[model samples]
Target: MDAAARQAVNLNVLRRHDPAISAIVDTSSHVVVYNFDSATETWKKVGIEGTMFLFRKESLNRYGIFVMNRLSTDNHNEELNSEMEIQVMGDYVIYRTLDDKVVGLWIYEASDRARIAKELEKWVVAARQMGAQCLQQSWIQFDVFSRHLAVFIICALAEDLLQSVDTDRVPSSVSATCMLARFRPDPPVSAHWFLKV
Candidate 1:
């Protein structure tokens, strides 16, 4: 398939599965994932050492499930453990354990949190519109991935825009501090939430 067609298919696959994945793509271009061992549940030396179809397709939509699956008992062997790492230069996130069962997750930045909000709203609205109370109820318990609440401020902005903005009006200084506080290891996934797709 042509690049565009492949991209479209990749997006559709991810979107149908989950929207959170797309959010990761908005902020950065690449991420890194780390995997763990199954038997001892410690850091394993084996890793996937390859790219995932989702990353190759270049869709942001599947990031959430991609992450969830890598961290959970989904699509991967139960013994597998995963984490995400971002490679700003490489434009992809590699998910793997020390063992090197690397599964590459394409990275995106900007929309991480917003995507979560949009998907949450979309699901809520769809449920209400369709009169699916059961589904709606189920969704209520789901927690948003905590990674997205952060704001990334350019270093130049820290020196320029933040200094000029009034503390009361927006508190640019405070905002910048908050952003830095939320910053995780650029890729955002640790052994805790990182997973393979």
Candidate 2:
């Protein structure tokens, strides 16, 4: 598909200076990106075949992402309430928006996937310590997460997926690359290299 003529967004573009983008759903079957027009200040969306990218600046401390884990064209409400409910069941990590959109994550495609889950859980716990613990008191407010921490979560689960998984299983380099370059605490690596592989 001609992704550009349609102005389809790439998560890796990492242009953080755009208008009010609320969320992105980079999934396997479809891509849903949400952004607000700076001039018109209206919500807009761009969808491609199987992944999505979105960008947004804060609005009234009310900016929250409203994406789940699948291909969807249903993110049409104009509310910034991004309260998410998170849960860890066994080794699975579940993330749900209060409106009931949900997705779960665990380690796969890595050797010793259980260890990856364990390590990821540690990071989740750390985020809880640093943010507002919410819902069942077991998870925390994801909106409170810094972009740095959010990038870590994406990379931690899919670190070795450089060549093994399809684009559907891989989080876009967009989510980690420029997103991290903006405020990453560690030295930046060439994410393009990974994506090219």
Candidate 3:
């Protein structure tokens, strides 16, 4: 099969069976985080190590909002320190201090489960030896495997809708709304609603 055909098949498989395998298979082009220096107002490239997720930019922003909310709610009274360790569960990442205090927690869907698990294990070992705190504490750089995943899914759905239409005219908003509903479903109003909202 041609490359496009193969990609279509792969995307179908991912959408149907494993939505978590969004990370780029090749590691060389993974996303890298850069640290912003408040003093100089400059962004410096931070070394990239461990597993990174390939999240749609919008999804990444949404995830950041969730993380910020968790940080505020969970660690409001706790002191921020440099001796924290990070652990990755199925879809959640947890942070704890050396004294075994939970400091932060965030939910992230992995691009590739097996690769992420392996990388998380390696990072745990490294964090144990070198500590988890960095120069800039608040910034996180996620490796985006492909920014096109969301767009591709939407476009594919749009094409299908167009093909099924009896006339040439179709409302763009209708397709957009359908796409949003398909990808992001509504959730109950609660503390964890940030993940879905």
Candidate 4:
């Protein structure tokens, strides 16, 4: 089968699984309608308001990281509200208003886990210095995928830091206990984990 044939078959399968996928794939246009509720006759436009990036994990692993912004509404119509249209883009993601005004620009990429963690640390310190906690909070509200990625990076960085610590340099009494506590990974890392340090 040719490339086009394979894509068609894939699209068919996607549409069969969830017809909403068709709306995203069929359009070359940037505008997307989401959180549609036929019963309430309400819908939201992607990148208009209440938009956030949901990382496609499979796509992130396969093709350098990718994310799509999902628009949400408060409509209580549950049955038809399951479908949401998001425009998945690579690298840079741009947000614009209906009047063609630039609202936001997001630069996302996958990098060495430890390096990213270090960068996040710097950001936290800088935020603290600049009294930008509110700014960070706003960021937290919108970027769900990046928050998950930050958790992973933090955990990796913690593991690396713990491994590099020389037990011989520390007092013998608490060394074993410290090592044991650092290695256990259950709750993963939290957004405020850097704040504790």
lDDT of 4 by residue, 1-197 (tens): 99578657745644453343432221111223243344675544434322211211122111111122234432111111112111223422323323333322233332322332343334334434444555575565547646656765776777677568886786777665575566544543565643422
Arrange candidates by lDDT, highest first: which order? 2, 1, 3, 4
Output the worst ten-in-a-row residue range by lDDT, candidate 3: 62-71
> Where does model 2 exceed 4 Å of error?
1-19, 22-49, 52-55, 66-83, 88-93, 99-197
Q: Which ten residues in a row have the lowest lDDT in candidate 2?
A: 48-57
Query: Residue 72's C-alpha lDDT in candidate 2?
Result: 49
lDDT of 3 by residue, 1-197 (tens): 99667656644543343353342232212332333455786545434323232222123221111111111222111222235444555544445645664422222336543454454445446444433333222122111212334555666777676667764364655664465556542332443322221
Q: What local lDDT score does residue 160 receive in model 4, on the 0 to 100 scale?
A: 78
lDDT of each residue in 20-62, candidate 2, tens digit only: 5443322222323334355785535433122222223344322
Question: Which lDDT values do the candidates have, in the order given?
Answer: 0.38, 0.39, 0.38, 0.37
Q: Give the runs in model 4 whose Cα sits over 4 Å from its true position.
A: 1-145, 173-197
Better of 1 and 4 by lDDT: 1
Model 2: which residue pairs collide? 11-174, 12-174, 21-56, 31-51
TM-score per candidate: 0.23, 0.23, 0.21, 0.19
lDDT of 1 by residue, 1-197 (tens): 89677667656655565443342222222223444445666543232322233221223122232332343334322111123222222433333434455444333443543343344334334434444544454444222333332222344445466568675887545675575445523534443342221
Q: Which lDDT value does model 4 have at 2?
A: 100
Sliding window of 10 residues with minimal summed lDDT for model 4: 75-84
Worst 10 contiguous positions by lDDT, candidate 1: 77-86
